[model samples]
Target chain A: MNKREELLTEKQIRRRTFIAFTFLFLFLGSAILGWQWLHRQPTDHGAIQPLRKVLDANEFIFSSLFSKKHFAKTYSKDLPLPHPRVNGKIGLNSAFDTATWKLHLVKAPGDTLLIGIDEIKALPKTEIIFDFKCIEGWSQVTHWGGVRFSDFVKKYGLDEQSKMMFAGLSTPDDEYYVGIDTKSMMHPQTILCYEMNGKPLPLNQGYPLRLIIPVKYGIKHLKRIGTISFSNYRPPDYWYERGYDYYSGL
Target chain B: MKKVIHKHPLAIRWLHWLNFPILTIMIWSGLLIYWANDVYRLGWGDRTVLKFFPGSFNKALNIPFRLAEGMSIHFVFMWLFAINGVIYFLYLVFSGEWKFIAPNRNSLKESWLVILHDLRIKRGLPPQKKYNAAQRIAYTAVIIMGLGMLLTGLAIYKPVQLNWLCAMFGGYEWARAEHFTITILLVLFFLIHIIQVIFAGWNNFRAMVTGFETENIDAKTETAMPTEPINTKSETDEQA
Candidate 1:
């Protein structure tokens, strides 16, 4: 071997080390900047709102690009019982009169309809047994029986004139609220649920009504729906405000 | 005579270093998400051998009530992670670096020998090229695990839309479990990789960063004695 091939020249080593360090410093600098960008509180959601916006944008793109007709996996009716766990109790904390409580809905500006439980039951009942996924990483195959939200919307002539972008639901005390995309709201599996496991909903299970959305995490399945409103803009969501995704889709 | 030989290419070095932080963040954020439902255990039924994590482990790490933040970070960084991985894989293919990375026909047998050598049960390591048999197998397996994580992640992320994928993995819950298991496996691979790098010494570690290593010219010429450590002096004694 030639003597020249025996070693890296002093200058060559220096140059390489300098170049490597430069790259390292550049990477570190970019990473710090990227971290700052991700943690920047651009919105009121939290310190990570900028990152949250990216996630929301992902949800938006997925929702817009994909057809909502895709059905969640449904199990055979003969399958074993599903024990639905009570995940959240934010809206269900308050005491309310079940008899006087009606589903207050806003079809359009200044157009309102107060739907009683009997009216909700009058719509064609849909019973689906599907996996109910929670954001917490657990899932249950729960059987839900109720009128499809789309059917109810159609029968009431809601969204007939103007297709709203979102469906907003709130608790009676308005402590908790969720805004769902109209497409997901009108999905065939989405229902204004009144029964669970072949029986009327227990008080803890949202009693009169709750939203049974198979295509969404349990968080979006707003319980004890007090008010239903259609909106062009995305309504404030309890969890979204608390730093969860606005879509909360499956 | 000493020779400064190219070890890792510039692109490979960059990708490797970039993946360090990216995978670290992925694992950290993944841990935050997993804390929500840390239900995995080592035993069947009620006879618990060990849990995925103890409550104290979570408390020590402050891994609580961060699901929303974790999900946001995960979804945002996942794009970067996937993109970097894709670019790295393409670079490996186009640059023909896969020759060093992909496990070949002799890898299984050689990997066992390498393992025995590592465990001090065998006298010496198997002869190697750019990467040893064990490294080739591990690196390839980690890449496959990355792909598995991506697929399983998508299945669980969009179970309804990606119903076929969910079904392929047995179900949505199974997909989540698979994803978590892969994450844990990647973590284990990372620990072992770091340990091996440390054991391999500075010349090997620096090659991953600076893309070159000083080796004895005689060592390069002698294919018969592959495992012999090159004794070569360089101008940069710090790297020696």
Candidate 2:
């Protein structure tokens, strides 16, 4: 208890009550109006424009502070998921043509490199066992084996293209696509995955090739990559257009 | 006859009231985020008594499939919540108001007595100050809970950038669980707090809103009650 209790007159108490409620209403009123205005704004992709704008700002701050020195923690390969769950099938068309599959690499539109699974396997292989996080809040400690995306970029002589603001990947049918920061793509753990649990990827798990990026949510791990392209501007993404953050960094 | 006494400072009242709505919105938005992975339940090994929520409950609240909106509101309002909490903490310390809010060693010894009084098993409450022993402990615990929420929120939000912090909270998944648990505890605290305020009656509630309480002339002896018990504790651990 406070030793100095300021005894007040009834008149003083009434005046304080008036001031208090007046301020309280004003504060609460503004909060309500602010939320209403936020929701009423036009949509940017799936989110309202204002919310998207902040997300953009948040991305800028997060990306600036993101460091390559800090790697995502790895677990023992023995502890990896025996059967990883598959999520999101927007671009995964149930169609024909695993035989004709060639990874189309586009550097500034005209410079194209057609790569086969053999070419990726020729390069050094990297395996990572990390908690593969999904934006939906579930995660799995799964093992992945692949050629590093950075190695693929280096081997293809796309050093200049790799330095661009973003890298966009799309499925063969081109229905589902993802745009990612070139910085994240350059992380040592970002891989052009061809193997999962020490075997060739299953058909449903992006069979021929997929992206295994440990630093981001699973949504950025575009599957069955038909084409890889570099961009100075943000590329179209499946989830970004459906109310997810364009960056979606972990 | 009734005499009025200043029970709360103007700054304290504003901070407390602001917290109610801000926190309510935070919890609401949090529910939307947790709806995606609501795995927690009050049960063990197939036995179950309660679920965080059922499908019907979520459907009624319109709380399902609003992850984007929930995330947007949560990220935006987190700054407000943190700022309000920090300001409240600083004011409590600098204004010497913590003396009334923070618990002493005696609080632990006396809190059970206050509880018995609350259950109406005891005939009378233990002599106390601006806050009873139970109140002092609860208020202090809540402030600590607020801090836990902020730290846990940061750990999960930027698990990559703040890898050290994420590890401190026992990695990302554990941090998420901690954040969710703290929210549940805060909601429980809110339920009890509201019920107690109702039990305390309008005269006591007005003290929060108006910063003044009108005391019955017959209870003037309480003027002495606030000092004697607390002065003894001051010599022990009141301010320690």
Candidate 3:
């Protein structure tokens, strides 16, 4: 006695159900095929081209909406890492001379500028405590003393070159590298870190100078500065070449 | 006399079916991502009853060293999951099908009886129009959980960019915990749903796919319906 009931025959129900199930199988079959196809595509810089496209699109959206006002929340200095953890030793493994370590800046294809740790420290020192998040799914509260990258750009008179699409950095041995977009580079929280806790950076934790962009995962916080360069296009990144998102924003 | 009833609309059936695979992929890929920080466990503080996942489980599932692959899949397939969910919600609202899906005041009370009946502690089912009370509650709860998954996923995904949203969910770590917990709940829901469907018998299950359910009328009832039209929807669809 239900409203909208109909007196269809058994054959009609059977026919309809058969058709419905056929369509269901077709959809599922196609879904499986699509998945296989996506994976089978040739890898483009360690990721499938389509997947990389999506990651790039994600970068576009996040960077487009990026604001300098938003800062990674600073925590109390008391909660700093008692036992610092380093996930990788790519660039830090090589023997290096801290005394001769001058940050090489390639302003253009030809123009190069050299800066020392004291020059970086001379601009202004800012102390910040924040959670340093790792892409491998762990986070620790850390205290870093550094010069705000914004001030460094201003002091070095690179205000014009700072607008480039990306700022690429490499370790002294050219092992670990990262390509950070200009917008994130100019964030108020972005700093060229020199001190960890209350003392000079430990040898393992990029002593002397390192990039500390809190707006990104720990991977983007390249340790042991060696060279810096800007380009209109995105520069090479170690993690990005291994299928990680280029933006890697927080 | 045998008769057929229009239980589900074509649109509802299509959307419902789409959700099955979409949700499966979302959960499977989510498991891949959560494997990185699989810290949740049953017992707390020193003594442990059950770990969320043992190393053996991870090995069996091939979940190790796949963070990059897991992330790429999760990020890419998220669009399909979100779009399907949004369309399903809109369709339910616009078609007035939500009436059958939404829980009523007596749902909690009746769902308990439904559970008892299924357990053989009771006899007759609560009078069901479209969905049983247990089904109403379970279905509604799942939709709410799906929405929770979306919001929590976004919060952890862009904590700095969407700081306000992340703060609303009690910050990064808490939001991740919430997201993982809801996933476990969804898995539970999926298991129970599959068991119920199989136990309900083939006739009832077929209705979902074909949009029609078969009903039987006794000879006396059939004979008494002489003055009425054979078709029910002919009048109901056009209104009284």
Candidate 4:
């Protein structure tokens, strides 16, 4: 057989190279544009806001599509631990007057109810042994006993207000706060946890009361709940301001 | 006589190169997320053999306190990764390029010979085709691994909404482990792939980039290979 001809002539090779490079340039240009667009999104304390939007969208979809009745897996018993690890120290740094600290319940702007731990304890108590997952990726199987938030909402007639889309919780000093969807807040396992491992919660673990939300990461389980507010719009979250997801659900 | 053979189709080359950077970014951002957890290890009960990463390693790499940034980048880039993979797979199916990469019945046995040849334990390679048997297996396995990453990633990302998927992989923590394990495997595959590309020389690498390769026409006939190139002119001409 005669010598085979070249698959691509010089002109063709140059043309192919030009096309390849052109496509590559186009791809790079689009990537840069995407990066700029992401950075330009509305930010919270310098954290990219588009990410927050993405998390909210994810939460909305999950809430609408999935059943709220689906509970987190309950362990037969709590894991043996001297104490759970302290993952964050943002709100725990101050010395607060525990005796005078009242749980401020906000219905709307300027409409508030100041209630004590006794008022919360007056409701029926529920106990659960469930895995507590943290955004930091560690998990602890811990026992908690408290009044379910749903029950508390019903008893206080907060459930009557149907426009409430989110529940905001804050520490006494308001140094740290979290925003939670009302649906997650009303989950069967969500509680105003005051007792842990069959005893009153230690000061390090949010002494009088903390939010125990099984459906969410530990970040949403706001400790030392000092203020509770119902809002139609999403409340500003500490972590969300710091670039973490607001939903932060499992 | 020496001749040029149309090797990788233009679309295939584009997809392959595009995946390289997209996957690199995915793995890099994944590492950033994994740094927050960094819990995997290889050992028995507490007698540690190798931690996924030691504290010193993390410090050296500055891997801590970046979870927020890592997560944001990961969530954003994931769309690109998934879309690219889906497009690539569709192209493979539609263009009939799957035949070159997908493993066949004889691939396992032939892959053994290919491996032996690679290791220099055997004298010569098995008969060369568009892709050798080992290449077919490795390429196919990588695609499957990509799918695994996507599934496991979704399972963990929305565990409650996709609880069934999470449960299918033995729950949330297990799904996370599966995702990380597959990532490590893909990284391993990437390393081996690079080494093979270097060993295979410039012509092979050029084919992936330029869509053509120089071949000895006499050798092609001696091997009794089909006259048509792996990527026929008809397929590439339209793109050209």
Candidate 5:
């Protein structure tokens, strides 16, 4: 009985020692695997869907929280706004007769109104001097004078509860389309700009009309606004399909 | 008729070893990034106590003045560092290993006693099975510091995008300063850890590497002992 007890005790001792060693090994191996896994390229598409969903949810919450901060600065008139060279013009390929040009406001079914540039000039004009930032990590300061987008929205009685989830801007031939977020479209800084540097916008700078929004990147500023539409569905964004965050706000 | 007993598991040994290279790479790449804006210092006015890096240090390191490459490498490796850290944390938490690493209520006082004993100012040592009180404190502190580094790094990286996080760290420049300070503390911790490892000598080092140690079992309870009887010298140990 004594010998048997001794043997059992020895076995238990060895097992305990073995368990300790096992734990050490588990931690060490896991740390190494973790290190390697982190360095590996992000190739799992199954993982990305969840991440994108989280990002979208977080963005909505964060944007709503930050929008209430009353933070705006006055820009000096003497500050020279750098004129960055135009990179690409997608929808402005075809020419349109100025006399025939009409800024269409799509309302109820068959209730669309054909408004001219002279009609836009008749509204209250607002001029802003602000910086225009590009995603390529460069910025330019420019003076834009135009009618406030909010003014038009209010003129047309577009309230916060409006069902329009999408805002679409297109060039004359509709070759290019840019989408604006409803929040940005209703922002006081967003304008249907017609003049640059105290003169009517040059032909190269979207002659008839363009978007001047301080809250967004330069890519969303669609030049030569031919038609503005309000829709329930998401409007197709020019840069979004090419892999960019949809809510590309400042 | 005696054999060594395994102490450290294979996993722990690998993780302990793997940390060396990953941490080294992170620090090296971080230095390269800091070279772009090395504005850290530890001095009151022009007293000249300590600058972040001496001119000689920069010369030896050969850090480039341009930020472009430094930024690229830093950004790329940051993902790896963060992912590894997150996984390590989750593993510890889920596997119940956090109990060992996390300090108990007595840890602070015991850590001071352990330090005194290690410094040879005190005779008796604290009761320790796996980690001494000092080790517990150091390890726990480093994890917390790692969290600080991650937070401060994010604050600096996306100041406008993560404006709230930036504000939490007391704004952009403060966050940068905090990040650099924490990094310096980590490097100091590494230096001290290596020194302690060397001080602990061959048996401790071998245990870490080979996952085995030669612990002695008394002749009277040789079979009852948890470890195998081996050639281990033990001086008289006083209770804490």
Candidate 6:
């Protein structure tokens, strides 16, 4: 009887040992797999269709909840943005032709009005320094001088109840574009920036006009403004469709 | 008479110890992320209540305002934390260790009795086994929570890449909040686990560290006991 008990115990012990070694092997195997996955450079620019689909669905669901009023309260203003970095050279190619530039306003379908840079200059110009956050984990403090979006709206009589959203200025070539919600457009810091860091807006920084909002990441501040539109329908955003949050607010 | 017996295996011992430092680093790095967005709290509008980390807590930790450093450390250490967790879980599953750790239908009732015994309200001592009902419940619950943390952590980390996971966890922000709360729960569990280990004393503790325990052989029980006796072959096989 004692011998039988001993044999059974021994069998159990052997099983445990086998299990332990198997687990160790599996651990090494998983680690190797993980390392391979991590080091593999992104081969497909738009590869992994299933993963992208999952990501898109997740973005839609997340944005819906994130834009909820209750959650927005957690988006605090305490964390300051760092020095803005240069990224995404879209439409700014040659020197900005300030002479030929016209800030086109599309109030309604087929109702487009063109305003020159001189006209924008006629509005009340304001300057302020604030951090410019980026979609990537970086930011920078920058000085911007331009007419406030609110001032521009008021001057053109565009701040009407019917106008629910605002679009930013970019080159005639639709390489770069930004769309902002109504609340962000009226923000005191939102500007049609004409100068940066005490000088006229650099050629690379959108010479004639650009949009700058302290409360948003730099993506929303479209450079080289060519056309501005106000609309009830959501405007086409350059980054939103690319998995970034539509309301890219700070 | 009570006799000393081994409870935790050597693999478990190493896994348990490894989790200590790895989880600590994870939590510390998570704190850095949380500090940047420390907006969560438990209270209604108007009257003030408890804050997450009062000024005193920050002062006590002396955590510097270094976001870059925080991010670097977090990204680097996350690999170790995640790998260790995955290995631990797989080990349990592959080794049939889940059988012992997982709670059964009788677990709830047994857990109440165990609790009552611990509180000194019950007359008789609890059943002697590798793990009591309370231990099983706590252990199983923590494992489940660990899985939860992983899910929520991934949801927040790659919200754009894994948007569906993010949505399932409520959202990116909610996942972050849930991850923080789970860390708090883990810390609480750690405290209780440590206290329990200490209360169990040297034999219990030594068994974990050394993978063996010295026990006085009861001659009568050895002869009369119906179960198989623990022998050298079983010990060696189990130890392996």
User: What local distance difference test score does each model get?
Assistant: 0.84, 0.86, 0.84, 0.81, 0.68, 0.66
**CA error at residue B80 for candidate 3, angstroms:** 1.0
lDDT for position B167 in model 3: 90
- The clash count for each model shown is 1, 0, 0, 0, 12, 16
lDDT of 6 by residue, B53-161 (tens): 6778766886546333344445556666777878888988887777787888888889989878877798774564567889899999899888888888776555543
Residue pairs clashing, model 1: A6-B2
Q: What is the TM-score of chain B alone in each candidate?
A: 0.88, 0.89, 0.91, 0.88, 0.86, 0.85
Worst 10 residues of 3 chain B by lDDT: B230-239
Q: Over the stretch A1-250, how does candidate 2's per-residue lDDT look in tens digits?
A: 4643444445555666788778778988987898788889999989888878888888887788777776788889666365799887767865948898999989766878888989889999999998888877878889889999889888988899988999999999998899999999999999999999999998888979999988898889988999999899999998888887888887
lDDT per residue for candidate 5 within A1-250, as digits (tens), equals 1011112234444554577567657866776686567446352222223333443454475466435132222267798667755755787778777668888876655777788898888999999886565544344567889999988777766664244776877887887777776767777778899999889987777878899876676778888888888776657777655434455565
Per-residue lDDT of A1-250 in model 3, one digit per residue for the tens? 3347666545656766899889888988998898889989987778888988887787777676678888777887555255668777889988899999999988888898999888887888988888787877677778888999889888888887798888999998999999998889999999999998878999888988888898999899999999989888889999999989888998
lDDT of 1 by residue, A1-250 (tens): 1112335555666577678878887997898787777665575575276687688789877776346568999988899975789888998998899999899888777888898999999989999999999999999999999999888988888865227788899999999999888888888899999999989998888989999998899988988999899888988888888888888787
lDDT of 1 by residue, B134-238 (tens): 889999999999889889998998899888889999998899999989988888998898899898898888777787777654644655534533433344364
Order the numbered candidates by TM-score, best leading. Answer: 3, 2, 1, 4, 5, 6
- lDDT digits (tens) for residues B58-94 of candidate 4: 8887878888878877876777788888998999999
Give the share of true interchain contacts found in each model: 0.55, 0.39, 0.59, 0.32, 0.00, 0.04
Error of 5 at B22 (Å): 2.5
lDDT of 1: 0.84
Residue A159 of model 1: what lDDT?
A: 63
Best by TM-score: 3
Give interface RMSD for all predictions. Answer: 4.8, 5.0, 1.9, 5.1, 10.1, 10.1
The TM-score obtained by chain A of candidate 4 when compared with the true chain A: 0.85
Candidate DockQ values, in order, are: 0.40, 0.31, 0.59, 0.35, 0.09, 0.06
